[model samples]
Target: MRIAVISDIHGNVKALKAVLDDLAHQAPDAIVNLGDCVSGPLWPEETAVLLRDLGWPTVCGNHDRVVAAGNVPQDNRTDSFTEAALSAESLDWLRRLKPAIRFSDEIFLCHGTPRNDDAYLTEVIDGRGSARTADEADILHRLDGEKAGLICCGHSHLPRVTHLPASGQTVLNPGSVGLQAYSDATPTPHVMANHSPHARYALIEEIKGTWTFILRAIDYDWQSAAQTAAANSRPDWAHALATGRMQDGA
Candidate 1:
């Protein structure tokens, strides 16, 4: 089985379209969307419509839940923008999304941790209270003994593949398709950065019961993507979309 995975498409239709165009060529057996689908100042409605049409297996994300529940973060102006941008139908669809998906007996998909939609599955907070790569034992602890051949997750907006030599379970994060960088306060204030304006995703192919993975960062019209953010008064998101780097000191 070949699976194409995407996550954190925070309302940037341009980036999502670019990634989907690339996927058209790859023709993976299944396409999995890891959510955080539309919670930015960009084209939320358009992005939601496109995904609805594509009809892929999707899991709910933290941002999606906030919006679906009409609980936009108090400090997050982007969430307010998203709430207004999405239609009632789109919000309803997001509200009904599964928190996790078992694509097959071998493969599982989730936005964050399998148990907590908000928890980081393979990342952890450091002594500084900032998120960072987790140790093998820590990762395993978070897994809580759930064993699948492949566990796919997102939410840190960082692309990574970890093969637990002990469990033979591979955890893959496809990274962010939109919003390349953002500062978060959960698990302590920290920033997530891709460091380049590229649409990111991943392809996993099962070969003889083993897995081969490819991480993709496809270039798109990031300038326009940034411009949209700027136009909507989210210069922070604009900077990230343009350079994939947080605005200096942001």
Candidate 2:
């Protein structure tokens, strides 16, 4: 069977529409959305409604919980769009979301870490990778041996595919559909329209006895998404939408 794995769709309806249209041709058996479904420059309510209508199984993202709670700290407000999206209704949905979901004997879905539901599995930074090495590895190891054959997680907003040979598990992050946020030595990668937008997702195909995880990036109308951010009085948000940079080079 084939499953389309999507994650971190942060309220960019335009990009989501493009992705849905593109994936339709592939004709997957199911589409599973790993969370961070709302809280962005665009209309989050519209995005939530669309996802609900599509019957996508979703988990709670960190920001999605903030929206559902309507309790974002004033200092963390990156843009006006962020401020506007925090509402009671959004919080309600987020509160209702399950932290982890088991798809089958082989597949599992989650927003953050399997150990702690609220953990943010950020990539290693500085020498911290060495000191914190065992922390990351241990969780992955446990998940591999006991949880499911394939473990998928969102929330880092970075795209990656890795195989845990010891545990016999494959872990994947499809990145962010709305915001890419893959910063390294470079400021950010500017993807042209011809290139599939910075927007990325994954396609899981089980052919024969093998499981393949293919990470796909698609280019969409980022400018329009930026415009939507600006119209919502979120210029910084628009800038972030166009550029894949994250806060503090995250």
Residue-by-residue lDDT tens digits, candidate 2, 197-231? 36778898998978988888787888888888788
Stretches off by above 4 angstroms in model 2 are: 78-91, 127-146, 182-197, 246-250
Alpha-carbon error at 59 in model 1, in Å? 0.3
Error of 1 at 83 (Å): 1.0
Q: Highest lDDT: give the candidate number.
A: 1
Give candidate 1's error at residue 29 in angstroms. 1.3
Which ten contiguous residues of candidate 1 have the minimum total lDDT? 124-133
Candidate 2 pairs with clashing backbones:
68-90, 68-91, 196-218, 196-219, 197-218, 197-219
